[model samples]
Target: MSGKLYLKDKLVDEELDLSMMQLTEIPVKEIEQLGSKVLKLNLSHNLLTCVPANLPLLTQLTSIDLSKNQIVELPENFGQLTKLKSLDLYSNQISKLPVSFAQLKSLKFLDLKENPLVPELAKAAGPCITANDCAKGFF
Candidate 1:
């Protein structure tokens, strides 16, 4: 059940759709090299507690799905991926978003439905908000 998908010396550019696999944690160390060029990754419906630190290496990534997990906070470098366009974070246990979220200038689609963030906080983290805002949003 631990099959790996690779491409060239690096991992495949295909989507790593591992959603709803009843996983509690992923071995990021094993996949660090694989994510270097990965474009899309699906890690939703797991029991992840934190965002993978090595994810930033995937500079070519465009989309990521992390919904229905146990993540409480995003990494400070989460916005380093300037190529990222879409992010799904619905139905998680997240209570607050990292200030770095505003660094995602290329971000277009963001899903934050059914979180514990308040309305006021959401507005503060509007599309135009800055990293200094540190407020949540209804994306």
Candidate 2:
């Protein structure tokens, strides 16, 4: 079944929560339906192997939770989420950030716990033990 949860509050017009859906992929079309109204997206606790390549189109997103998945890497154009502030990637197989990641100037919080990053990158990343710690890895 395609599980979906929609939320809204005074601050946000819309949010899409698809946690624990056992999904291998994100329903881009369905998500696109909400357009710029969507701000937060939750895809944690699934079996996703990769993030959607077209994720950069959702420029309105501010927060995204992609934790507890099998994802190995993020979309090449992930840096296009210039408005994004918070990102959770806990317990994934990600090793390194893409070159374009440096473009995420608006990012304020990041979580990269449990990822198997290479020693060189890990040293640069430091202890990704918490969201605060992960934020230190980047500018």
Candidate 3:
């Protein structure tokens, strides 16, 4: 899947906007080439089903958008993204999160609405839309 890569509006390496690329897979090599310079990466609105587990190598990522896609299961080590403060996984085919999801200690905002999640897992995850009401269930 060939997709365009763009610097986030000021020619800075801190943010990369790769959204709406119609990509079938994560551009791991390109992203890794960017190294720790990127703090945010947007992969939303694409055709990705599973992301490369090595994605966590970009340790500088503070936020990532994987919303509005066809992803069914995230990489098992996805929670290794400890620096991620915000994660948007809305409107996907995810039913249960990986057990390692507990490793996301720094995650502050998570959107899990509109997923056909398993009842138990969904209940445990709550809405996770806000820190006040859905804080305890984020895992």
Top of the candidates by TM-score: 2
Estimate, for each residue in 63-128, the C-alpha lDDT of model 3 and write its tens digit. 888888888888888878889998888888888888777888899778778888999978776765
**TM-score of each candidate?**
0.73, 0.85, 0.83
Q: Which candidate order results from sorting by TM-score in descending order?
A: 2, 3, 1
Candidate 1 local lDDT, 80-103, one digit each (tens): 778888788877766677777777
Candidate 3, TM-score vs. the true structure?
0.83
* Per-candidate clashes, comma-separated: 1, 0, 0
Compared with the true structure, what per-residue lDDT tens digits does model 2 show for residues 1-139? 1355343322244668778867899877777776777798888999999998888778888999999999999888999999999888889999988888888888988887789987887777667666666666467
Candidate 3 local accuracy as lDDT?
Answer: 0.78
The predicted structure with the larger TM-score, 2 or 3, is: 2
Model 1 Cα shift for residue 102 (angstroms): 1.3
lDDT sort, best first: 2, 3, 1
Question: With candidate 2 superimposed using the best TM-score fit, by how many Å does residue 27's alpha carbon deviate from the native?
Answer: 0.8
Q: What CA root-mean-square deviation does each model show from the true structure?
A: 6.1, 3.2, 2.9
Candidate 1: residue pairs that collide: 112-139
